[model samples]
Target: MSSSDLAAVVVTVCVVVALVALIAVLTQAFALMREFRRKLEDFDSKVGPALSQLADTAEMAQAEIGRLRDLLNIAQKVAGLAESAGAATARVAATPVDKVRSAISVLRGAQTGGTGQRGKAEEEGRETGSGGESTAAGSESRGR
Candidate 1:
């Protein structure tokens, strides 16, 4: 055989081996891709419901947070009203009632003699009827 013919034979063998190697690599790649796709499908089937439930939970939490915020606003309004009521009560207590009671006392003292006014006032208070504890204290003070 000629050297050129031998060279040609060697080249043909090399090309056949390369084709085989390429076919093997392509087959392995196809099998790996198929396995990856199957695993992805399995993951989707298992985790899809849980992910949907998580989204629902998040929406519920958001709604609850809004309700809590509204509750907080109502609480703050109530607190402000309470503060205003306290201030109004303090203003009323600082003025009027004491002046009216003093005026009434003066009128009663004029009706009774000045010396007998204390006893007369105590008797009138008892007749009007007060709590049991104060009645006891009044009786004790009278004894003294």
Candidate 2:
């Protein structure tokens, strides 16, 4: 063929090859995008529930922490009240007969502050002691 005809044929072949390459690249890009979309959908199907469960766990933990904070606040108040009570008992124990009514008032006031067990134990101790032999004898007679 003539040189000009050869040049035209070469240019045509190059253009066709470039077009084929462009089509191949576009096909690969589309396939990769489809695979990525499928993977994201699969992850959503599995991970969505897991993330929700984690959120619930975090919410429960937060609730428990709030309860613990309230418990600590109650504990601090009880400790303060107990300290005041110890001071009152100390003063009462040091004084004489006139403080008996005040000591009864202290016990009655302490009864409402969640010291029922301690109060009952103290009552039992008092009943069993030699300091109140007449009340113990009365209880023994009642049990018969």
Candidate 3:
């Protein structure tokens, strides 16, 4: 064969080899892409429900927090009412207690003859040298 023809044939063989390698590489790339698409679909099918469930859980937690807050508000109001009731009870009780104490003091003063001086019986007892015990014994002997 001629030298120019031989060089042309060699170039043509190398081009054919390169084309075959490119085809093989393209085929492998297409297969890899198909596997990647299938795995992505599987991941979506598995993770989609989990994502939805997570969203539902978050909503439920928010609802529970709101409920707890409402309960706390009610408890605070109840505590305030209880404190008010306690103060009212104290005020209501104090007036009656003070009135009763004053009435008892007035009764005591009446029994004591309503004067700063001693009663007549106490004055007579002090005028006599003996205490009122001797007078009570003499009265008891007379009753027997």
Maximum-TM-score candidate: 1
Predictions: Cα RMSD each: 11.3, 18.4, 5.9
Error of 2 at 25 (Å): 1.3
lDDT of each model, Cα atoms only? 0.84, 0.82, 0.84
Q: Give the TM-score of candidate 2.
A: 0.60
Candidate 2, residue 107: the lDDT equals 68
lDDT by residue for model 3 over 1-144, one digit each (tens)?
Answer: 999999999999999999999999999999999999999999999999999999999999999999999999999999999999999999999999999999999977675553323344445776896657756754554444
Instruction: Give the higher-TM-score candidate: 1 or 2.
Output: 1
lDDT (Cα, 0-100) at 18 in candidate 2: 100
Candidate 2 C-alpha lDDT tens digits along 98-143: 5787887886676554355544555786877843664555455444
Better of 1 and 2 by lDDT: 1
**Candidate 1 lDDT score at position 139:** 60
What candidate 2 gets wrong by more than 4 Å, as runs, is 96-144
Clashing pairs in 2: none
How many steric overlaps does candidate 3 have?
A: 0
